[model samples]
Target: MPRSRGTNGTDMNTELGIVVAGVSTIYGRAVVRWAAAEAHARHAELRLVTAQPAAAVPDRYLPNDVATAHRAAAVRLLADLAGEMATGWPGVIVTTDLATGPPAAVLRAAAEEADLLVVGADDASPFTEAISGSVPGDLLTTSPCPLAVVPRREWTASTALPASAPVVVALDESTISHAALAYGYAAAARTGRPLTVVRCVTAGSFDQAAATAQARLLIAFGELYPDVAVSTEVEPGDPRHVLVAASRRAALLVLGSRGRGRLASSLFGSVSRDLIRRSGCPVVIARTQPAPVALCS
Candidate 1:
């Protein structure tokens, strides 16, 4: 079950909800900064969540005091940074909350009402890699909102594109891919950037049939955003690799979260995960909502 809602309904505001976890790590700090900047721009409130488990407490009470103090120090560090950032971005209100269970599970539950959830890609401890393993994977699979996994070393502080940066959308011959393209086109129009639609066909599969489908998708994309300049490409390689490579040069990688699923409980298909893990640019994972059809008299 999802987390219960708050009575004031402010907790349910999708636009204002963002779950930023793992603030003790460098990657988490990057995510927090980026998310706070975005929240300020969008007039959204930020929620910072940290986790500390009792299992880490030493059996001896004296050592346990030291452990608890360390955890408190880490939390205080994050709170201080968030406070400083909040001062610069007054529109972004930051709240700090602590959870007692697994970090990922706690953060995932909070993501239910969020428009976006941000977390660190790695941490500092030796077991950091192991601890972070399932959190990102599970969140990518089940997060109710879009998830942004910030790499330890980011290219820039802002993921938002420049005024002229092209918006890239990965399109395959699937319903989800088509919806992703539509969302990308709409976003391009909204941001006043040229739209680029990329279709990745396997090297051997790049033939006339694939070309025809690519052309049709391109035409459809153009029709959706007639005012925006649009370009299309049919690359040859693994779709995930091609999309990730292309995303490096593009402003935003717009993609769909739900794809054709052959397995159970697969929130994001294999291709999506690969791109999310490896893409150099910030990715925008659109929810699988049905796009509204154009009405004509």
Candidate 2:
């Protein structure tokens, strides 16, 4: 049995909300499995959200039949996923909701009270890469909680329970990055993995201010994960480039979905989106979503 408990030993009443978008894609099953497993592990509630065009029928400008068809499709997709999940994990509470808006905004609102938000990595539209306009990319930018980007393949137990793996987290001395750090530490503690914090600075001469910032971030990690082994690195290069390079040897790469400066772009910010597309390991984007009351243990 899974029990939900906060780090501070409180019960969490809210569910671990998963925003499932692009149900028409091949990655749908994988996203469902991953979300179900995570919810089971955390003993959190799971909700499936879908967004469709909301023009009313009959008296409206658009045909209601079109909306009905869309709703039916969403329902079928959820049913298929529910059937698949039930085989492996029964009694898992799953709910479905349909909203009318862009996929990102609809899921974000549905996940308003959720502990974690999950989205598929596929961009259903053609202009995905040029604009980073995919739903997952958009959610990373504006989600109210932590976001998990699931690839189009199920995560095997072997992958989740690797021996002596490293949890790599990128830190930049910002509040968002600190949240990433906190998530990394918690993950490292729960998984019994060593924690490594990497700070990437632009390729240039190292200055005292940069070095001090790096040291402070490392110290914070040390304080957070005192029982676990923690390592720090300060490298000079494009943040994404360095982080992805480091991710090759890591089991998981944790990053902040957004940063403090206006310099960060809209599309998953530059570093996070790049790593998500390129990293060989799983990537967890720590954003400002609702915190779960209890995490299943």
Candidate 3:
């Protein structure tokens, strides 16, 4: 990915960071539109990427022209999407990259320079491909930055979220959870939305000390983002259930990625998979150093 340049030809990076979106499928188109709106809101550069499957070596059944045509189509798609974003979002620095490779490879390469990678997933569908291998699932494990998995929904005038929708972040006694909290607070502050920090415990047990500790962690972020209205919710139920319910009215649901080992840290555990599959809004997996988390397990 090329770096953005200032008027004096100096290289500069956007504070919100570079946003990469895959734009090859119907779901991907929605993802790009959502990402464009987000990049515009945050004054970030948006890179629209699409990939053409690399040609197989020593193929006798397929002709070269077919591959050429496929590449042509991919080019057209990227150009059209770039044009749409330019028309819709005038000031956003939009760029397009059409790479020759698998869908996952192209997007992951683009994510190397991205602060957040936005992709589309069907909420009603189970992530069977997550285990079997798919783009969003692959990128979820490989993306160096936070991954925003937006559910396919009937968007209102290409608006990703309503004007006043709250940003919800699930928290626990973990450093990664603090990162998630910070991510949520920054998002809320950027969009002028309220913030909700949720902690879930078992049905019959509640630890006031832990709750207090979690609440205390919010003070730093609150001071940093004094304008955002912050609230806390301690719910008695499964973490997935509580967070999904909270997502019903939220603009975005932020969760920390936690586990041990390289593979475990990258993999989305059951709670995150369930939230991504069933949540009422877009679910963002905030990437940070791995840590054990009761809320995210």
Candidate 4:
């Protein structure tokens, strides 16, 4: 991952952060639709924000007049998006913010209050090959909340998914990995989708002890999401490749941070970034999960 010019952190905030440029930026609508679906499902607020350098930016890009015009256009774009969501997704409360500064920095500040920060890929093959800076590119490493970058190809309002389109989640030995599983299961349950638990296994990767641990995690999810149809796969191969391919038929892919061994800091790991670029569906990097609440009788 390239170095980010912004602060890095894990755990998506309670709000939804949608990163938008003045124009559609190509895949912006896909992100908004996805975020709207998420907000509706989680019963959370949607925060649509457009971060810009400045209307009076000191040369290099657009002139002051042109830049100011661009900012105004972007603000209008947010209003249009908010209006569409308000009508299209009734239960999801939508709001907009237009801030002046570095887009990435504004994104980080916005992420601070977002449970999931959604962005669209400027370059379609960004993950497979290499490309320039993207809204979620450098920022991926330090996103305070889980980040979802819908691919240009997958950015659409089509809810037409086959029943087989499951919510596939990658599992690891990390304690935080369970958070990814829980998130995946909940997403599946909410949307009445199936859930698939996958762990990439090498030849001798699953020793008896490891197998038992994996079963434990699967069983835990089953207990929680008893009504959701579930399947398990100990696929043989690289985890990133396996998940990326599987995502072609998936509705979403959820993953956990590859923790800094013992250092106790979180950064978006290699697998998460690779999949975000390559996955056919939306990819979510599970930063942190909110604590379970008890029902008051």
- What C-alpha lDDT do the candidate models reach, one value each? 0.60, 0.59, 0.68, 0.63
Q: Quote each prediction's TM-score.
A: 0.73, 0.72, 0.81, 0.76
Higher-TM-score candidate among 1 and 4?
A: 4
Off by over 4 Å in 1: 1-22, 53-64, 122-136, 159-162, 182-192, 203-229, 259-268, 271-273, 295-297
Could you give candidate 2's per-residue lDDT for residues 1-297 as a string of tens digits?
Answer: 133443233454554434333343455666666677766655655566666644445325557786567678878877666566656666555655656665666666766677777666543432122114444344665666777765434555225656667888876533335457667877787667888888665644445664565466556556656887888787766776787787777767787644323212232265566666677666777763332332100
lDDT of 1 by residue, 1-297 (tens): 233332223454354445454455455666677677656655666777666644654546557777678678768876776776677667566766666666666676767767666665445632133234543455655666666655555545444556566778776543335446665777577657788888666534445654565466557667767898987787766776788788777766776656222211132355655565676766666556554443110
lDDT of 4 by residue, 113-208 (tens): 567777765543222121224433445656676667667664543277887789988764333365677678888998888998877665544556
Question: Over the stretch 85-199, how does candidate 3's per-residue lDDT look in tens digits?
Answer: 8778887777778776666666778888787887766622222233223544566656677788877774432255677679998864323365577678888887788888876
Q: What's the CA error at residue 149 for candidate 4, in Å?
A: 1.7
Model 4 TM-score, all chains together = 0.76
How many angstroms is residue 285 displaced in model 4 relative to the true structure, after the best TM-score fit?
A: 0.5
Q: Candidate 3 or 4, higher lDDT?
A: 3
Task: Judging by TM-score, tell me the better candidate of 1 and 3.
Answer: 3
Winner on TM-score between 2 and 3 is: 3
Question: How are the candidates ranked when ordered by TM-score, highest leading?
Answer: 3, 4, 1, 2
Candidate 1 accuracy as lDDT? 0.60
Q: What is the C-alpha RMSD of each candidate to the true structure, in Å?
A: 5.3, 7.0, 5.2, 7.7
The TM-score of candidate 3 is: 0.81
Candidate 4 C-alpha error for residue 183, in Å: 0.7
Point out where model 2 deviates above 4 Å: 1-24, 55-69, 90-92, 123-131, 134-138, 157-161, 173-176, 205-224, 257-268, 288-297
Per-residue lDDT for 269 in model 3? 54
Which scores higher on TM-score, 1 or 2? 1
